[model samples]
Target chain A: MTNVDTILKDMIIIPKGIFFRGSNASPDEQPIKQILLSAFAIDKTPITNKQFRAFVEQGGYDDPTFWQPKGWAYIRENEIKYPNYWYDNHFNQDDHPVTGVSWWEAMAYAKFAGKTLPTEAQWEYACKGTDDRKYPWGNKEPTLAYANFAYDCDPTELVRSSTSVYDHPKYKSFFGCLDMAGNLAEWCLDNASTNYKWDRDGKDPIYITKDEDYHMVRGGCGLHNEDFLRCTARDYYPVSVRDNLIGFRCVVNNVKEEEL
Target chain B: MDILDLPQVEESRRMVCVCNWSIRRTWKGVRLATIIEKAGVSNTNNYFLKQISVGTKEKGVYESTIPLEDALSRNALLVHSVDGAPLPMEQGYPLRLFDFGLYGYKNVKGLSILEVTDIYELGEWERRAGYDKDGIIRPKKYWMVDLKGWGFAEKPGEMTDF
Candidate 1:
């Protein structure tokens, strides 16, 4: 298969279902609610360095059609020709998740790849599944074996860096997605709000605000403590701040006739 | 010089990370100015300070640089304790710099080497990881971990609002 075909084939199909979206973990994730979502195909792992390298080399940054107007303008203004860590040898491994991408860049990539970022509801549903597990891999606390987290005050371990996308198979989510609990937090489609404003039952709920506002990043990364790694945990960054702690995955919705 | 032997002062300050997290805690350490003065480095403005740490090989050794003036500022501290407790190993047990004016990267942890040089040097993160050279705490929305809430810093440089 071609590289694009292989990348497309690696997506995991999450069937349509009803799942609890939030938890009592934090005020932002308060008032646990059930959300219904259509079937969607999500990248099994985050977009890898190799996968995104194609986007960069294929003139992804140069193409305006693949980018939002704001994103296009921002890139042109700052002259952002590539991912922030594109040339950094430490983070640019073939199989490692690409980091240092802002939500706008991630959106551009998803558009370029013929997909879109998963909505916050979709992302959280796929993570917790029907079980409402505290973590993607279930309720057990995070360790180096389960996720690539910076161990809490562990003296012996020194460096904290993102490993290969699938370094820890045990970190898989309920839908058999890898690295959903850690590596690099994945950007979602929705803009971030201080707390959930959706009703208790909603379908494919997404809280989009002004394009320039902060956007949500789900899961956690190597630098975060266990609290941020919980399935219901929520964090966000301004749409333009491209730090190394965030990356993204693409999703293609399998819209059923009933939904249409 | 043993950092513990130096005279110390305790101050509560907000430690901000470039990654959008902040925490306010009491840190006890000797002021950087005191250490620099004791080392007989009187002409502080003529040089830069490089803070090096014993980080892992895979990620490269962690290093950060600051202007000599900022390094010798009253807020710059070589901290060894937090909240009445000695620093944990992960928190840079032996000695670490606490400069609230800059991001967490500039307050280098696991600190092992302190080099004073005439020329400005880019830090490890700045050289290899695409971080800003100065890493000043910029105005942004930050998750206040200790407060269990969110805060917006309206001003850039030297976050003193606890």
Candidate 2:
């Protein structure tokens, strides 16, 4: 069995609460609405190259049981053996957040860890908390000190690449989730929708589709500007396209009400 | 060759990124066919055109390879201006190729070299990441940055639903 300690050690238990979703910043983020989310434990930081190495070494990619049917077919058809940037020296450091992973690969990794990708509501709540904050940290705009983003970092000290997941000590969210603002945008469980125009009120609202369409990605990446780094900012990518700027964190829903 | 010295076409076109976002803007530049003809290059072998870009430190050198027929199409343009202004440095400054029928990756930014070859060379993103070498614009729901919302491209190829 894969050691549970590595995946569960730093999990932060977020209390059940209501947090506002969406923002007026962009049309996609319009008509801010309150979303209720159940208590869930989230990884303290994004899954790192070191953490994912275990999954790869354990033949996570070769196992079909861990992946959805469509995802499995895609991996087989594309002959995907590992993350897209698996061998790239620039992004292959042990502690850097693992990127170049498609949404399906992320889903497989989550399954391998016995966890699930966070629903968009859970992810937003984890970052925004009870208060409606513009960013993960607070209302203030992002500087390099807050998050790793484009046009912000000094080129001398850092190359234009993802830093170690442990680098941003100050960019923690309300629920103590680190690297939630920028590093690599995290994948959420929901399928891509233009806006929150549907009925997502009340508790544990998650959007899924019968079709294997594009999936949502949240937080921002090292390559995007501050506008995309906001907590409410959203984007999507095809399930099979492995991008270097996208990574993910996993979460486990609390089973016991008393545990909350 | 100075691209600005060649014949230019001022037209508006849509550029769809493989990431599923797209934008439409008025572009001003010389056609790839015009530039090729002015350079006195022969494509009798139906060779592919390899485009290289002066890419940034973050992205390295961006590259794209297009079939000779597509390169000579009326829509294949080496864009220098967008939306009535000089192309922003981030948008590839002086010159960038906009192959309207293909995904944005095919439109190499900050173009530096144009080589003719018979072999099908994979572009930078296709080589580094696992992008499709063809880079065609597929019918999909694109997050239209210009429209500030999602827009569906009902048909494939160049998105002309203005």
TM-score (C-alpha) between model 2 and the true structure: 0.74
| lDDT of prediction 1 | 0.80
Over 4 Å off, model 1: A1-8, A153-159, A199-201, A256-260, B1-11, B18-23, B26-162
Please give the lDDT score at residue B95 for candidate 1.
Answer: 85
| Per-residue lDDT of candidate 2, residues A110-188 (tens digit) | 9998899998888888888888888888899888888877642213335556788878777678888889887789999
How many angstroms is residue A171 displaced in model 2 relative to the true structure, after the best TM-score fit?
A: 3.1
- Lowest lDDT 10-residue stretch of candidate 2 chain A: A151-160
| CA lDDT scores, all candidates in order | 0.80, 0.80
Native contacts present in each candidate (fraction) = 0.00, 0.23
DockQ score, prediction 2: 0.22
What is candidate 1's lDDT per residue for A15-126, written digit by digit as tens? Answer: 7889877776576785777788888888889999999988999999999999999999978977888888777776788999998887889999998888999988888877
DockQ of each: 0.09, 0.22
